[model samples]
Target: MSAPRIIQVASGKGGVGKTWLSITLAEALAEMNRSVLLFDGDLGLANVDVQLGLSPKHDLGSVIAGRARLDEAITKYEIPSVSGAGGGARFDVLAGKSGSGVLSALTKAEISGITRGLKVLSDRYAHIVVDLAAGLDQGVMSLCMPGSTTLVVVTDEPTSLTDAYAFIKLLSIQEPAADIRIVVNMANDREHAWRTHAALTNACKNFLGLNPPLAGFVPRDDLVRDAIRHQTPILFRHPQAKASEAVRRLANDLLLPVPRPATIISTSSRK
Candidate 1:
C-alpha cells in the first residue's frame, strides 16, 4: 500500500498560532473522512494534548524510555461533532515528549529512532500533520528537511517575516525543489494578508532565489480565541465563524489535485 502523506506545519517563530492551525487542519481533514494522525512534533514542549484539554498518560518520551510502546503513546481523540458531516470525526494523536528536561536530554539516536517509528506508523493514516517547533534548529530541521510537504505560517510583523524568510532560506538551500507553501495567519484584512505573503515571497525570490507558493491566509477573528478558550477547534466549535470557514475552505483547497510549484490557491482568489 502507498504510504500516508506527511505535512510539516512550521513557523519562523512561536506564537503564530501554528499549533492551532495544525490541530484545526487535522480536524478539517478528519471531517472529510481522511483518517489523520496529529503528531505533537514540538517534542519537548508537547502542548497539543493540553490544547485539546486532554491529559495523555503516555507520550513519545514514554516510548523512547522503554516504559511504554508506541501504541500506548498514541491516543484516540474523537473529533467534535460536525453538523453536515456524516459522522463525528475520529483521529489519533501521538503526544510529544513533555517537559524541558526531556527536550534537552534527548539524544540524536533516540530522536532518529522516534522519526523512524513515525515513518512506520504513518502507514496507518491518510495524513500525518506534524506541528514542528519554531526555528531552524537541529530538531526542527531534522523533521522539516525530510520528504514531507511543508506549510510555513507567518504574520505581518517584520520580525515574523524576516525570521520566516531565514528559516525557509535554510530549508531551500537543503532542498532546492522545496516549494513550501505560505500561510498568513492573524491577518487584519485581505490587503494586509496579501502584503505579508508578497513581502515574504519577494524576499525569498530576490535574496534566496526561491519562489514559495502562497497557500492562503487566516483573518483575525475573535472566534478563534473563543474556541481556544473552550479547548475546542474552531473548525468544529464554530464552523460558521469566519476563521472556521476560512480553515474549512483551506481544507478543501488542500484536498484538491495539485503538484509541486502549484500549491493550493490563496483563499482570497477562491471567493
Candidate 2:
C-alpha cells in the first residue's frame, strides 16, 4: 500500500479560500477512490464544522485534554452528488475546537501529543488534507515543517503577495529542503495566475533562494462565494462553476500519479 500523503493547504492572508480548497481537495481525492481526511488545524477559529453544518460531539479540545481519543473527534462527511446521482465522494473530518481560546497558547506537550495522534492515524487514510490556520504563526509553522506538501494560496492584492513571500521566506530559512507550492486564488484570468506565480517565485529565488512551484489557480467567480454562503463546497454544489472546475483540475493533478517512461537501461554489462 502507498504511504499517506499529508497535504497542507495554507494561506498567507485570510479569505483566500484555503478552507474551500481543503474541503474540495479532500472530496476530489475521495472521488478518485483515495481515502482522504480533511483535518481542521485551526483550533481557535475552527469553522470547517460550521461550514459543513456539522456539530461534532467531540473535537480536538477533548483529545488534547485526554477526555477523548483522536479518532473520536473525527466525523465523516459525504459530498452531495453534483449530477444528481446516487453516489458521491466521502471523507472524514477531524474537527477542531471553535472558540477555544488562542491557538498560540497551545502548550508544547499538547502540540507534540497532537502530532503523535496524527502520525498514528496517518496509516488509515491515503491523503490527509490539513487546513492550517492563516498567517505564519509558530504553531502553524510547526505543523507544516514536516514532509507535508505545502500549498500557499495568495490573491492578487499587494498585501497578499507580500505576506505570501514572507511566509515562504521564513519556511525556506527554517526548512530549506521543503518544496512549497503556490496556488493563485481570485485571479482575473490564467495569465493573472501565471504572473502572480512568477512574481512570487522570482522573489523567493532572488532573495530567499527557494523555488516554489506553481500548482494551479482559481479565477474570480461569484459562484465560489455563493457556495461558501450556502456552506457547501463549490465543486459539489456547482461543479460547472469556473472556480470548481479549476479546483477539480488541481485535485486531479495532485492525486493522480504520473507514469515514468519505460526502457530503463541497466548499468551492469549487457549481453
Query: Among these predicted structures, which one has the highest lDDT?
Result: 1
- In candidate 1, position 188 carries an lDDT of 87
**Model 1 Cα lDDT, one tens digit per residue, 60-112:** 77787798988778998875553534237777898886554476356777677
lDDT of each: 0.79, 0.78
Residue pairs that clash (backbone atoms under 3 angstroms), model 2:
none
Task: Give Cα distance to truth, residue 197, candidate 2, Å.
Answer: 0.8
Please give the range of 10 consecutive residues that has the lowest summed lDDT in model 2.
262-271
What does the lDDT come to for candidate 2? 0.78
**Mind giving the per-residue lDDT tens digits that candidate 2 earns over 151-177?**
899988888888899888777656655
**TM-score per candidate, in order?**
0.89, 0.89
True-vs-predicted CA distance for residue 12, candidate 2, Å: 1.9
Off by over 4 Å in 2: 1-4, 81-87, 256-271
RMSD of each: 5.7, 6.9
- In candidate 2, how many clashes are counted? 0
